[model samples]
Every structure is written in structure tokens, then in C-alpha cells.
Target chain A: MTRLELLAPMTGRVVPMEEVPDPVFSEKMLGDGLAIEPSEGLAVAPMAGSLVVFHSAGHAFAIEGPESVSVLVHLGLETVSLKGAGFERLAEVGDTVAAGQPIVKMDLAAIAAAGLRSISPIVLPQLDEGWRISKTNAATVQAGRDVLITIER
Target chain B: MQVKAQAYLEALGGPANIKDIEGCITRLRMTLIDPSKIDVRKLQAAGMVGRPMIIGKGVQVVVGTYAELIGAEINKILKQK
Candidate 1:
């Protein structure tokens, strides 16, 4: 069995996935993971892998890391309606990235001004059978520096 | 995956019931002509992870990262009709 570690995509208070406003995320519909009420505007690669999915609206992105574990970082709640207005993409889809590398930058103030919540959900999207995940107990975490999730197979 | 898409389409009340469908990273969001026509049981059988969230005329199906592919497939089926 092997284990994979995922770092926080942005600095923020780590909250249980259930705390995310979206039912899809809060209910773990997509997969099990956590959310971060980001205090910083920058989002980084949680682990080294190919940048697989980068939403055109800039509200979300996913990275496929080792052990075939894919981590999705969704920027905010209902921010997709903003249509990329408060986001800047620093990396393109298919780009090979390293852990902690900056992939996107957000204008948190703009999101707030638009009356959107900036609570970002970090999701597994898909969890294969036999794989288990654990989250950090820390109330807050630093982007790319703190471990957010650990997966074991 | 195409088969799953077809199942998802049927679960969403088929092409005639769909007004628009788009995929975000984790879910397929659709606007349906008749939200009441959606078959929640079929959606769960077709691999939908969570309950189909229906808000007014809009419905969101959480299909993980395959959301885009499934959305495109459903759109293709819609186009063919």
C-alpha cells in the first residue's frame, strides 16, 4: 500500500467539507475532502501532476497526482456565475505542475463585492475502492506548506 | 461512458425535457423544461454520487470529473434528436 499527501491549495481556515455551502460538496457528493475559507487570493497545486481540468469560468481546477489521485480545488460558492471576472489563471490545462506551484490567483475582494462566498472546497472528486482518506485537524492551514489530506491505499 | 450518459439523459427526463446543460468540474448542471420529470432513482442507479439537486428549473447531477464528458455526450444526444 502507498500513501499520498495533499497540501492546502490556499491558505485558510480548514473546515469540514460539510461546512461548504454547496450541497454537492457539503454532502460529499463529489467525494470526501475538506474546504478552506481562503484568507489569501492565490491557489496552488496541491500535489505534482498534470493540470487536468481548469474550468473556463476559473471557479475550479483539478490536478491528477501520483497514485492516480485527483484533487479538485473549487474557488468559491456560486462564483461560476461571475464568469471569470475575479479570477486569473496562472497555469493552463495539461501543464505539468509541481506541488505548491501557483496555478491560479483570485481577487477575494471582488468575489466578496459580488456577494459570493469565498469558501473553497478541495475535493477528491473520485475515490476508488480500497482507498482511504484523512484530513488535517488544524483549524487553519498555509497554502502549499501544510498537509490537508492524506490518502492511503 | 456513452451508455452512462444516455442513462443520465433519460434520468433527466430525456432530450425534450432538457433546456440547457453545462458541466463544471464536478457536476453537470442542467436546466430542465419539467423538473418534476426527473427520475431520482434512475440517476442514482446510473452512478450519480449524491441526490440530484433541483432548484426551480435547474438540476445539478454530481458525476465527479467525468461531468464534462457526460455533459457533452448528453448534448450530442440532444443534437441528434
Candidate 2:
């Protein structure tokens, strides 16, 4: 089976989702993946796909690609209350995005001042049967450069 | 001081209007019974930083870092009745 690699959507330190703190994500209720303690203010598309779900708040988004693989990019822990103050949307729903294309711009300083952690969780919500997902061991990842997820179908 | 989650919930038309609640690092994501019921003035008064967004069947409220705590509180309220 050929392995499909999903690159990092943002630059940050990659941590296991189990460290996310929020039970929903930590327990893999939303799906299994890794989290990033982001250092930059921008998030890009990890893979070329069409945006299936785009929140107006720019806090979270879900993209669906071929082979029934869907990925969710959630910014911060509880930043939904920031109400898009520090977030900027670069793409809209149904837009076709290329891998490494900027999709959201954020003010990390502003988010920190608001007392929100800028830890982002990138999850694969749609894992079909017989598909295996694995995480890369890279401690720090660069957007469009490092492959954080490897999938074998 | 930022508005308490309880106050925000009250201004959001109570738990009855809430269909579901989820939180990310900086926001309180919710599914509301009626998006029109949201009072922007009250939300701002309660210390929300930005405008609310209605996405599909859900609404997202920017709650900063305390979003998870607030989410937990909301869940507690939901369980009560």
C-alpha cells in the first residue's frame, strides 16, 4: 500500500492529542491526530482539498479530500470567544485549496493576551476501515515542509 | 474582568436555546436553537471580544482561554435540567 503523507499546516511544536487537555480532543472523541503549540500566526492547508466546514470565527475548519479523508484544523483551546478578533480568514467554504496555501491568519499575541492558548489540533475525523494513521516524530514542524501524519490505506 | 460563563449563557438565551456546546482554545462553539436570539450588546457587555459567528447549525462565541472551563460549566447546566 502506498502511504499518504499529510504535512503540517502550521509551524509549531507537535504534541500528541492526548496532551490537548480538552477531553473531547484528548480522548479522541472528535478523531485522532496531533496538536501543535503554534509559533506562527498563520495556518495553511495541509493537503489540497475543498473546505467542507469553515467557521465564521476562523477558529476551526474542516477540509475533505479524495479517498474520504477529512481533516479538521482547530485553532486554540477556547478562542471561540475571541469572536474572530484575532483571526483572519484567507479562504471560504467550497474553495479549492492547495497544500501550504494560507487559509487563516491570526494574531498570536492578541490571542495570548486574551488568555487563550494557541495550541492547534489537526485531526482526521474520517478514518475509513483498514486505514492506518501514524504520527511523525519530529518535535517541531514547519508548514508545508514537514509531514506530520502518515496514512496507509 | 471578562464576563462569567454563567452570565454569558444567560445572555445567550439560556441553556434552552443551546443545542450543543464545544470549546476550542479560545472560543465557545455552540449550536443554538435560534441564532437571532443572540444579543450582541449583552455579549459585549459580558466581555466577549468579537462578533459571534453562525456556522451551519452552530454558533461560535469567543471566550478566550477560559473557554473549556466555560464549556464545562455549560455542560453542568445542561445536565441539571
Candidate 3:
């Protein structure tokens, strides 16, 4: 299995990600990835890959890149209803992205007053492979921070 | 806050049984292990209150916050075999 390099969604605090179970771990609990306080200002690529699973709402996307890595980004609550009204899609499906590449942007505060969460989740689907991947601290991250998640096969 | 849900990767007869696992508008869409071990009643019991929905060929659990944790645990459990 090839190693998939993952990156932190934001330069936020790198605390130990809790191992939650059942109803507590669902998307609904986070209120559509809220508390992370999303923004219409900008949602950049945490890594390079095919931009798959861009919700019609334009608030979320699932990116697939090298090593079969899948990264899902949910922008805000019900922001999908905006229907791409606020966010600007920087790239199209199957397009390759690089670390720190700009994908979308908008106002952060405005997104929350509207009643939504900003907690973004960076996930790895094929994380089951027998490889060694290490993640850094989930500190308050910026777009271009060197938050490397290297998976060694 | 607090959450709970039932997770399965082995019930599908190991990860080999699943073609893919993804989430949608509400439910976590899963391509299953023969779709035989997918007992809605049993899955629901594991989830406490949230019921399981058969969306298309995928058997889904209404995992809220427990979604990620359940997923994490499933991944760990599956990797052990």
C-alpha cells in the first residue's frame, strides 16, 4: 500500500482527537461541522488531489489525491442552500490541488451569525492500509502551515 | 456533547465485502458484506435510539457525533484481523 499524506484542515490546536462512539460522532452532533466556525471567506486545499464530492451547496467537498487519500471539508450549516452564492469554486472535479492552494473563500463571522458551526473534519478513508502515518498537533492552523500526515507503506 | 451509534465493517464479512463507505445528507452510506448481516433491528439496538436506513444498496446508521468515533473504532477493529 502506498503511503497517503494527510494534512491538518486548519492550523488550530493539535489536541488528541477523541475516539467517540455512536450518536456522539455523527455529522449532526457537530451541527454540520460547526463550532469549528466556518467562513465564506476561504476554504483552501489541505492537500493535492481530485476534488470529489463537492456538495451542491458548495459548503463541503471530499477530495481524493495521491495514495487514495480522501479529505472531506464541510463549510457551514445549511450553507449549501446558498447554492454557491457566496463561495467561489477555485477548481473543478478531478483537478489536482497542492498544499496551501486556494479553493474557496468568504466571511467567517457572517457564516456563524447565521447559525452554523465551523468545525472542519479532515478524514482518511483508506487509512486502513498497513502503513505508518503520523499527524501533527491540531493547533490553530493557517492555510499554508506544514501540517504533514505522511503514511508510509 | 455525548453520542452513541453502532458501527460495522466486519459484519460485511471483512472490509473486502465493502466496496465503499461514505456519508450523505444524513446517513452514512455503506456498500455491504452480502447485505445479509445488516439486521436493521440489531444495528438499531447498537445505536440506542437512531434507526438504520436502507438507502439504496447501502445500509446506513444515523450516526451523529458517534459517527467519527464509531468510524474510528471500526477502523481499529477491522485492522486487527
Candidate 4:
């Protein structure tokens, strides 16, 4: 069995994915995961892997690690409509990233000013029947240092 | 298993119902002419990851990382017709 630990992509209060306002995330439509009401604007890589999917809008990106495990970090709810206005891409797709390396820098104030929720969802978009996932119990987590999600397969 | 774009288009009420469609990382965001015509069961059968969501004339199908490819495929089919 392979075990993968996903670090918190940003410092924030960790909440269950169900609390995200958007049904796409709260309903766990994409996959089971957690959300964070970010207290900072910087998002980091959740694991050591090659950056695979980085949205042009800079609202989301995914990293593929050992065992083909992928973790997606979405900056905020409906931020995609912003079309990269308040987001800055720090890392490009295909770049090898380590857990905690900065990926995108978001302007939280601007996002909120645009009337969008800044609660970010960290999801495992791909999972198999043999995989098991565990979420962190901590109310608040530090980026790159705290284990946010654990996956085993 | 990757879902065939043709299957997704059919599940979404075919190319005629789709007014606009785009990929947003993990989901296909679409504006349909008749949102009610979307078949959730058909979408599931087409390998959708979770329940498809409808908000007014807009429908979102969570197709994970392959959303871009699927959206492009659907668009190609729409252009052909």
C-alpha cells in the first residue's frame, strides 16, 4: 500500500467540504475533500509531484504525486469568473513542485470585493475503489507544515 | 474510465441543447437551451464522477481532469452540426 500526505496549501481554518457554499463542492460532486477559509493569499503545492493541471484562470491547480495520486487546490468559489484578475500564477504546469511550494498568489481582498467567497476547496478529483482518505482534525492549519489530508492505496 | 464526449453530449440533451460550454478545471460549465432535458442518469452512465447540477439554464457536469478534452470534443461535435 502507498501512503500520501497532502499538506495544507494555505494557512486557514479547515472546514468540511460540505460547508462550501457552491453545490459543486459542498455536494462533493468533484470528489471528497476539505475546504479552507483562507487567512492568507498564497497557495502552495499540497504534495511533492509534477504540476499537472493549472487552470488558465489561476483559480485551481492539481499536483500528481507518487502512485498517481493527484490533489487539486481551488482558490475560491466561483473565482473562475474573475478570469485571473485577482490571481497570479506562481508556478506553471509541468513544474516539479514540493509540498508547500508556492503555486498561486491570490488577492483575497479583491476577490471578496467582487462578492465572491474566498473559501478554497482541496479535493482529490481522482480516486479508485481501493483508496482511503483521512482529513485533518485540526480547526486551523499552517501551510506546508500541517497534514491536511492523508491518502492510502 | 474516460467518458466519451459523444455520450456526454447526448446525456446533456445533445448538441442542440448546448448554447455554450466550457471547461473549468474539473467540471464542464454549460448553458443549455433546455436545461430540463439533461438526463442525470445518462450522465452517470456516461462516467460522470458525481451528480450533475442545474442552476437555471446552466448545468455543470463534474468530469474531473478530462473536462477540457470533453468540452472540446463536445464543441467539435456542435460545430459539425
Q: Highest lDDT: which candidate?
A: 1
Q: lDDT by residue for model 1 over A1-153, one digit each (tens)?
A: 899999999998998988787788888877889999999999999999999988888889999988788999999998878988999999999999999999999999999999999999999977788988888999999999999999898
Worst 10 residues of 4 chain A by lDDT: A22-31
TM-score evaluated only on chain B, model 2: 0.87
lDDT of 3: 0.52
Worst 10 residues of 1 chain A by lDDT: A21-30
In terms of DockQ, which candidate is stronger, 1 or 2? 1
Best by TM-score: 1
TM-score of each: 0.91, 0.68, 0.55, 0.90
lDDT of 3 by residue, A20-55 (tens): 122323423322221233323566777778776565
TM-score of 2: 0.68
Residue A15 shift from truth in candidate 1, angstroms: 1.3
Q: Supply candidate 2's per-residue lDDT for A126.
A: 40
Q: Per-model TM-score of chain A alone?
A: 0.98, 0.97, 0.70, 0.97
Q: Candidate 2 or 4, higher DockQ?
A: 4
Classified by CAPRI criteria, candidate 4 counts as medium
If both were scored by TM-score, which would come out higher, candidate 2 or candidate 3? Answer: 2
